[model samples]
Target chain A: MIRDKLCAGTALGRRIADSRDRLYRVALAWCGDEMLADDLVQETIETGILKSRQLKDENRLYSWLYRILKNAWYASLRKNKGHETLDEELLADEAGPFSNCQQLEIVVQVRQAIGRLPAEQRQVISLVDLDGLPYCEVAEALEIPIGTVMSRLHRARKGLLGKMTTAPSGAMTANRILHLVE
Target chain B: MENTEYSLDDQTLGSFVDGMLDAAHSETVIRAMDQDQDVRERVHQLHLVKDLMKVGFGHTKAPSAHSKKTRLATWRLFSPRIAASVAALFVVFAAGMLSQPYVNGQPGFPGEMLAAFSPVLSDSDNVILHISESDPQQFAAALLYAEKFLQEHRSQGYQVDVVAHAGGLDVMRADVSPLKLQMIEMLSRYDNVHFVGCANAIRVLREKGINPPIIAGVSTKDTAFDHIVGRLTSGSWKYIRVDSLVDNPGSA
Candidate 1:
């Protein structure tokens, strides 16, 4: 039967393998934490599988998965009583915190800066800048028009520039300084 | 370390960095950099800043290694019936004509009839457009049509969102054209009309030092144009060409 043929072609295995990284990165960006991102990615994958039948075109597996991720992010955010402030301590420099640790510090600051962005801007930057998806692809995943993607990316970059330009020089620590240089 | 000063705006510089400039323009920037210490320093600073940001943000850990355990656990949770349902449809095509075909005016194929008669159908109201052309007039006209359509339909409880992607984003830029400026202003009045530009475009633009305002629209989804086309073909939502809307309002 045609149905049996369709069943055999269930692309769940391939879809999971291809989207694992993208889903993880999206989750990480949304939650701004590693463990949560992992959990979200897992949840997204499971949901993607359950809803695979709804995905009429298997070629669009990644976009379909991303839609599920976006939905999950929103649902989680809503249930959590909207936005939460980023923990400054995670970003603050510690005494003599690993000299030549500029990379770690810069990473922290960047993450903090990203956290400061509006949810939509953050999502856009994460998918395009961090994940390195093409603009068209990012548009598909976000389910927005490409123009919106460009706008959000612009805002996010501008926000980053503002944050970095204004951040105190000494407050960055030597490690953070080296991180920027290297 | 001298600060860079030059007449070129950030967007122009950004375009230069993005390699979007033609030879003559690039020659001009290169000559300016040679003659102006401040401009040179500024360009250097911009490069440094971009590198720093890329380093800070680009280091994402691989997801597959971390998610393997959780995926297995979740896979175990599927009930046999549910799993069968998920796995069964694929098998239906292999088995010949398991369900009776019903006549709906035209003889309905099994799948088509089932889709039509399905009790759990949900309405797809989302409309996403891809505007890749760069003509500001066409872009503005599209926005005008979208505004009119949304205005007419919102009270009828319809949700319409207009998003411009790629070259179409020029219309949303503050400096593009007077017509575009008015389009952006008027389009913003409707809470439902979302204007978005592509991030890749922004990155390319920003690298050249252009600072365009971020439009309040959804970020671009890859291959989303195809998705929109698919939806239009399926009668999910009416997809109107901007020109068609202007020329043939009744059909659009």
Candidate 2:
């Protein structure tokens, strides 16, 4: 009995570890705070493990995990008192593409552009474009219909394009690289 | 430049880029894109947007120190209880199996027990047979059975789609197979038959310098295996292994 429990636990642990990075990225993208993202990710993993038995189809694990992470992000957001004062330097450190920028000006602008995005657009763009999830899978993760996914993605792309084009040349170049991939 | 309004909307363009468009439709879109500068520019911009997004997201690093410790502590507390439950279930299952009587020197389990249980198993009032092989005899038998079945279900509105993929591409190839020609002619009269090929497979074939005639059907978005699995799980389709279908038509 002990051996069986250990085996189940190990299997669950491995799945959580395999999905940790993506879940953390999603959480970070949704919440925009490293500490809160971490907390959300941890809560998601814990909840997923406890409810793993409820998952009937193993093939849907990725979508199921994404759903859990989405729920946790929303729950954490509701519990928090307004937007937390995010440390700009620390956030810049966490931001990709700007991590190596020794020029503080470029990093600040890039971070600001990301921060300026409406929360809904930011989350949709992050999951679909940044994460590269297929439209169907993104719909499953967000608990929205495929049409909603398409509309949100379209809006997010429009918003991001507007921001990137208007930013300074240096930030635009960096953002062009970032936005193109998304 | 001749002004021709492209019918390919954003959804279709996205689907085309994602390789989700059916073959005939994709061919039409590709030809249009080649002829139109605006279409080409839009595609290029979309590609650029995708690349920029990848760079912006950054690499996924390992978990932080605090998270690692919390995970370890949680595991330590929960492991024992889970272990006990698993062991108890295993023991009960083993005991039940052992207590069963033997028949004909084999375990007296019913025939139904032998069939595997799929994770997303379901039942259907009608079955759709997806055929994607080049065997003429097998194809003929499948068609005969499907036709008879359709005749019975015609009033009830039962649907069946016979999708041909990969080597089965020859089954729907315009020029190669006379049997394919006859099958297509017969299927054209039926409202519920669908024949498809894998577009990715055709692309791979083209890259290898093989100009196998394009099948006269839509290409599946994913691999044949994924499509089959999805259909079977959803209970919309059932696999009739060509060999099994032909060899034991009465049984199937």
Candidate 3:
């Protein structure tokens, strides 16, 4: 029994370490504040470790961790009350767009387009399209019906098509395109 | 493979794009796409959207990935001392369990006792009002309704969070909102009230190279309605859509 318990604990630890990067990226996408994203990830990992025993099936670990991360992000939002904690000077030093000009432009355009989607649709798109989770898993994480997930993902993709295609070639940035659309 | 008349619905199409469909249904959709140009184009656009989203968000790894020391610093926040305390408590409880009779197990200590002593705060009332209108008159009407809401429930210790987004950003802008002074006064008067603007809306203006004057007191969220929806799903929050509220005042 002791040996089995040790193996289970190690397996849960490995699962958490494997998911850290994906969880951080999703948190950043959801909140757009780097500091808050870090806080969310840290809290998620800590909570996962503390409550790892409650998790019954090993096969369900992936969706279970995603649910924990989502709940942690929401709780942080409630506690902090919509505070912006992104350090501009720090971001400028690191992650301030790469030298690959065309690739950089495409990235900016896509990010802004995703940002413009309605909040409900954006959540579904973030999980399904960006994070590459299955539709059923996305529904489980958000605690919504599966049909709602499909509809939201459809609307989100349609919105992105308009935003991505309508931008002026070469000369205009995402904000100008967004302003024009508005 | 000759089912051209059987059109695929949005959910089926989306499921196909996400690879959630079974092999048999997936083959049917592919066959239909080959026969219909419209279906093919939509399937392609949906694929493009998914690819674009992946390129946008997937490549941007957290900066903490590069700094092991910084990651350790964050881990330190959880504290080994607290973990040790929890571990010690578990060991002591285990010893007590082994020493006792197996008759009932006595509700297993601490969690049940804590629950018995804890007060019920779940009965408290909360609400969220989302204002998505740019009209100054609408803003005034929404604020008036907020005032009435607080007056009725302030004695009961109710909480309210007001969120503004999209064209709603205008209501929180100092240069644009006609009720800017009134907003400032309301902020000072009500400790329970909060006004939040959408951060993505602000980012759009900044990226356009047009900086507008913004009011000082309002907070900025990643998305306004998403925050409200999160609260609504978790707890019993009476959600008042201020745009709709202004359209039908008697119903609100």
Lowest lDDT sum, 10 consecutive residues, model 2 chain A, at A96-105
Q: Model 3: per-residue lDDT, tens digit, A31-75? A: 654555667776777777668898888766756777887888777
Off by over 4 Å in 3: A1-9, A82-99, A168-182, B1-8, B65-252
Model 2, C-alpha of A150: deviation from truth (Å): 0.5
Give a tens-digit lDDT track for model 2, residues B128-180.
44455666544544444455556556776556655555566565566665345
Top of the candidates by lDDT: 3
> Residue B125 CA error for candidate 3 (Å)?
42
**DockQ, per-model, please?**
0.07, 0.06, 0.14
Candidate 3 interface RMSD to the true structure? 14.3
Clashing pairs in 3: none
Candidates 1 and 3, the one with greater DockQ: 3
lDDT of 2 by residue, A1-182 (tens): 22234335577656765676787766655655555666677777777777878887876777778889878777765766454422221132243322121222333333345555666666667776667677787788888887777666666555555665686422345444443334
lDDT string, candidate 1, B184-206, tens digits: 45455666665555555656667
The parts of candidate 1 lying over 4 Å away from their true place are: A1-12, A53-61, A82-100, A173-182, B1-54, B62-252
Per-residue lDDT, model 1, residue B37, is: 92
